[model samples]
Target: MSVQRGGLGRVTHIIGEGLEGRIANRHLALFGLGFVGLFFVLPILLLIPESLNLGSTTPFESYRRVANGIYVDAFVRSFLYGFVTTVVTLALAYMLSYFLAFSTERVRTAMILIIVPLWIAYIVRYFGILLFLSPAGPLADLTGFETDLLFTTPAVIIGLANVYLPFAVLPIYNSLNAIDEELVNASRVLGAGKWRTITKVIFPLSLPGLVAAGLIVFILAAGSFLGPAVLGGPNQTMIANVIAQAFLDNFNIQFASALAIVYTVLLVGLLLVFNTLFDLQEVLGNI
Candidate 1:
């Protein structure tokens, strides 16, 4: 009886502790969460039946089809390209945003330039890149060097990074711009040099934005359809391409369903690992 009472006390204590200023406006997020829940997540859940053949002796058949060597390679290629694109996009966006935040007076003009591309359709922007990278395009006209960059891995990554640059920049700039000027002045007064001040104070304060940008870019890049379709070759095909092929061209609903399920699972697993490593809630809480 004492052990039962002790356990019950512990459970109550845990719940009480959790309720004490621990949940940061989580209720407000329910609308956006509801959209994912009702639209994206629910639809994905509904695909489970289509992904299996329960009437047959082998219900796991579609999943088995996904284990093929080519399909495996596509999954690996998709994630690898996603990671590389996120890194490159973040680096470029951070530098650009830092300049916009601190270095430049023409922030309005620069922001206009950065934002203008987002107004353009993705296919149009990708097609423009296609022209620029092609052997017959402006690059070849100037350099007189016809290159195979148009239909390769590097081209695809470049396209993904460029396409997603604005997403990263906006979030990071908001974070950077929100920082108090007094804090920066205080750091300088405390004998922290320019680089030291930026690295130690500015960057840490900006992490919430950086983390938000990373998640947005990573998800978009991983599931990209147009970038790889326009810029990559057969060797560079990603999972999205295969899913498109299965669903659109081949009309293989079961195969497409299986691919979608696997991709969703893998993406969620990766995000979970990322959250664990970064302690994202803690990082954002500081903001």
Candidate 2:
């Protein structure tokens, strides 16, 4: 009986040791997740009470103000910018990604070149665009034609498209790369021409990446402050710029917090809508 009890105790100890080892292996990942959650949650917690108008007994007053005409226009303009930027970025990125995925032998080199622009600071890139468009800048110097291009809606769109182009490219390229080569061959064997193969086979398979890229670019562009602030004129200011002005220039934290909360909720709602309409989980997984 003593021998039997001793054997059971040994088995229990071994099982406990294995569980500890398994947990140890996952500790780093758990810690990383916790750290990121804390980082994101702390700011949100700080903002929530302010957004609710803490200590003022006027909950949602700021939100009511945000829904007024002026702010409503800003929201509409922001969405417009997001949509236009998404369309332009998608057009440029799809072609580049397709080339990189299917036509290129130097895929690594081409990808590196495409990503090189991102290494420069975002502000610097915008400034470069500003300079290039300026009357005295290189474009004028080369063409001997001066034009005023700064502080316009077109300038803002150009800046956004340039800045977010790589983001769209990478996901689309990933989707295109994931397509089976055999599928393309099979399509060709079925008497499909080059254009038809691309339209039917490649494009359908790449929709996940395209959708993911569109969502990402639209979100970023819609929430953008710097691009609009620097490249846009008075009328081109976005919701993000308005939000910043509420906090910084006007020193209205409550209003700013309300705007932030509203904007965040709207974006989250949009994402939820998209997820319901499309298989966003599968799209994200493919990415």
Over 135-237, each residue of candidate 1 has an lDDT whose tens digit, in order, gives 8999999999998898899999999999999999999998999999899999999999999999999999999989989999999999999999999999889
What is the lDDT, from 0 to 100, of the residue 128 in candidate 1? 95
What is candidate 2's lDDT per residue for 1-287, written digit by digit as tens? 35555788889988987887567657878898888889987887788888777567778889999999989989889989999999999999999999999998999999998899999998999999989988889999999998777888898999999999999999999999999999999999999999999999999999999998999899999999989988888989899999999999999998999998888888899889989999788877766
Q: Which ten residues in a row have the lowest lDDT in candidate 2?
A: 1-10
Give the range of the ten consecutive residues with the poorest summed lDDT in model 1.
1-10
Per-model TM-score on C-alpha atoms: 0.86, 0.88
Clashes of 2: 0
lDDT of each: 0.94, 0.91
**For all the candidates, what are their Cα RMSDs to the real structure?**
12.2, 7.2
Q: List residue ranges in candidate 1 displaced over 4 A.
A: 1-38, 285-287
Clashes of 1: 0
Best by lDDT: 1
